[model samples]
Target: MRTNQSSQEEVEKTLQSITGIERASPNPFFLTRVEARLAARRSAPGVTTPWAFRPVWVAASLGLALMLNVSAVMYAREALTQDDQEQETVSLSAEWGFDATVMDW
Candidate 1:
């Protein structure tokens, strides 16, 4: 209850502190100057590089990268499968008390 009263007093003080506030005034030509600068920027010609920014080239490069990524993933999967098969064959040979080197394909 005491804290609430103190907070209310602080709020009253804060409200009284801004009693003499005044509105801001703008310069007369500020808007026209800003508009002129905007117009100049809009009318200026922009620079562009020749080779690397074309849509066709970008798409073609992206497609090539995707294809290479897919091929690499497939190759990795095939190699992993081959390794698993070889491991499985070794484990089977060991379990059956057979020589792994003599297993016929």
Candidate 2:
């Protein structure tokens, strides 16, 4: 019972100490200045955001990337087809028993 009473008194003292405390507030012109800066930024030109959000630049970049990818794909396909043709020719020559060493000018 005595311990409980002491704890209650301590809690009361803590609450009393906090009761007279004042609330913190920002500077009076702080919000005004922040709003003004935001407005100025919005009105300013040539502010580039992230690449994905820019209108003209994003479209152009995507178009260029697409063209490069298509070109790469076409080149790779051509290379693969040429390699396949060479392999087929070698296989056909081997099957037909054509000896390169026996060929004389």
Against the true structure, whose lDDT is highest? 1
55-101, model 2: which lDDT tens digit per residue?
Answer: 99888989999999999999999999999997887787789977634
Per-candidate local distance difference test:
0.91, 0.89
Clashing pairs in 1: none
Provide TM-scores for the models.
Answer: 0.52, 0.46
True-structure RMSD, every candidate: 10.6, 8.0
Residue 21 error for model 2, in Å? 67
Scanning candidate 1 in windows of ten residues, the lowest lDDT window is 44-53
C-alpha positional error of residue 23 in candidate 1 after TM-score superposition, expressed in Å: 69
| Per-residue lDDT of model 1, residues 10-39, tens digit only | 999999988877888889999999999999
- The parts of candidate 1 lying over 4 Å away from their true place are 1-49
What's the residue-level lDDT of 73 in candidate 2? 100
Model 2: C-alpha RMSD to truth? 8.0
